[model samples]
Target: MNDTLHVVEKLTEWRARALEFEREIQKAVLGQARVIRLVTICIFARGHVLIEGDVGVGKTTLLRSASRALGGDFARVEGTVDM
Candidate 1:
């Protein structure tokens, strides 16, 4: 009985923490909740993401923001015409 109660308590605490985390992400990422959600899903699933966009389209900003939020390393490199 004590163990079950402890598990339920921990779950409740995690739920509250998750809600707070979602709110923080929303605050940091304005007007791109969908993109944030997709990124979150990818991270949750342990998958890599390839963001395709033209220059100055917020791709780097989005990836960097996501990396900061997820507490990981972020790196960027410019591409050239040579293959």
Candidate 2:
């Protein structure tokens, strides 16, 4: 019983942190609330995400914003074809 209560308390704290993180990202990202929430959920779940969108659709910005909000490092990789 004590262990279950501890787990629940930790989950509550994590949920609060995740909500705050999402709000921080929202300040830097405009008109992408759904995407931001999805990203936040992914982060909380400890899952990887692959974001696909048209060029100039703020994909990089989204990740960077989230990273900044979480006080973590962000890196981007570009693909190129070499002949």
lDDT of each: 0.72, 0.91
**Tens digits of per-residue lDDT for model 1 on 4-73?**
9999999899667555555556765678777766766676567998788778767777877677776788
Q: Output the lDDT of residue 66, model 1.
A: 71
Model 2, residue pairs in steric clash:
none
Please list the residue runs of candidate 1 whose C-alpha ends up more than 4 Å from where it truly belongs after superposition: 1-22
Write one digit per residue (lDDT tens) for candidate 2, span 1-83.
99999999999999899889988998888999999989998988899999998999999999999999978999888865762
Q: Please give the clash total of every predicted structure, in order.
A: 0, 0
| Top candidate when judged by lDDT against the true structure | 2
Model 2: runs farther than 4 Å from truth?
Answer: 1-4, 80-83
Error of 1 at 50 (Å): 0.8
* Alpha-carbon shift of residue 52 in model 2 (angstroms): 0.4
Superposition error at 27 for model 1 (Å): 3.8
Q: How well does candidate 1 score on lDDT at residue 1?
A: 100
